[model samples]
Target: GAALAERVAAAGGVIGRDDLAAPTAEWAEPVRQDGIWVTPAPTRGPALLAALAGERVLVGGPTGEGTSVVAAADGEGNAVVMVHSNSHPQFGSGLVAEPYDLVLSNRAGRGFHPDPGHPDGPAPGRRPPTTLHAWALDTRGTGRPDLFGATPGGEQQVPWNAQVLGDLMTTGPDDLGAILTRPRWSLQDGARVPVEASASAVRPAHVLLRVTGTGLTAAADPRIGAVALGV
Candidate 1:
């Protein structure tokens, strides 16, 4: 389909009148990793949740850098929604119309395949898997609903957020700045990006971290510079 679109759009190519139909967007069930919910949105919510579960991090930490959610139902039924994204801008270029002045070019349909047997196999107008994550929590006393999201390409966003959660829950960083200033993610992909630390701290052997609050806690990989700030 991509090939067709590119060729048809080539110089003086004979593309049928109906060939250029309006594109459509669709939604599907979110993927779950380690009990955390993840949607394919170019972010890392599920991975973060999983890491937090592993670490057993609690909410109400002195300094944690993640967005979480909480919900409660009283005798009278009611519903609420609260969401937040890290709001970090991607910095690069390639695609046209740099509306955000950043390179989301890596998000182009590369992992997708044409074979039905493959996990990322292509289907007619089907949406590709995204890295974005949406999480929620619910309890009786208080209702806190939060959404932690970002746009780090690949899975870079997960580890960054997870480490911050660890610092907040386990290491007990004094403030948000201290947690962030600590030596952060070291990319697994050495060929692409070298792993580096901002401060002198032992890096985890595994490239994953998790955080948990009173209602729900989650972890993510920070290798992609993913962060989870409060809404």
Candidate 2:
């Protein structure tokens, strides 16, 4: 973990806390926002059984906003997009960084304890996994992007982006500002937080977009410090 931290720092990434101690409990619990409290318990048994019996079960929960994403486009139907993050900012190996390559820290757990049965379960000296991603929609066979965007929140990345995509397709194809500024939501396994323009929900991450044939115009969520430039 220490060697990985040195490499990440050399590559211009930020390293936060590091915990080398043993885990306190057998299973990790879901972390909620302030004023919320719940017990840490093993994943329910029937839920697993039902899933094995071909029943769909929703899993996962909210996570820290340790990822960053960027996109760029030029005339002539060319575009490029990138999404990145440090996984859990405050837990797991407690290393908040965006290294050029992948991570090699014990903090890969991202606060979720190892479940021997799960695929993403924690193991020794494994690269911390992440859901960080970038998206660009293609119109038929055309390579140009009809819409492209990225978000930083861990588990909220997909859910939040889904909302943005739905709205962009339905209401605000050209209104990028209006689309991103609208209320956003984050949900995992039925736990929901109607994220609004506040510190926790709005501060850490936001959408950045570039639309083709929009006359060199670009927009970024004001809630974040990202900027858009024209070449």
User: Which candidate has the highest TM-score of all?
Assistant: 2
Cα lDDT for residue 128, candidate 1: 54
- For model 1, the superposed segments whose C-alpha errors exceed 4 Å read 1-8, 11-43, 55-106, 113-116, 133-141, 146-153, 171-174, 187-194, 197-231
Superposition-based RMSD of candidate 1 using all C-alpha atoms, in angstroms? 10.9
List per-prediction Cα lDDT, in the order shown: 0.38, 0.52
Write candidate 1's Cα lDDT for 39-119 as tens digits. Answer: 544334555676567743221111112233322222233322233322222321133322333322323243355467775
Candidate 2, 1-231: lDDT as tens digits = 565657657766665236434234344343222211112223222232333334654545336655566777777646555664444543334434444444453334453446755665655544334455455543223444555566666555556665665666567556777777887765644556676623354343445455555444466776667666677
Model 2 stretches astray by more than 4 angstroms: 1-62, 90-107, 111-113, 122-129, 139-144, 188-191, 197-204, 211-215
lDDT agreement of model 1 with the native:
0.38
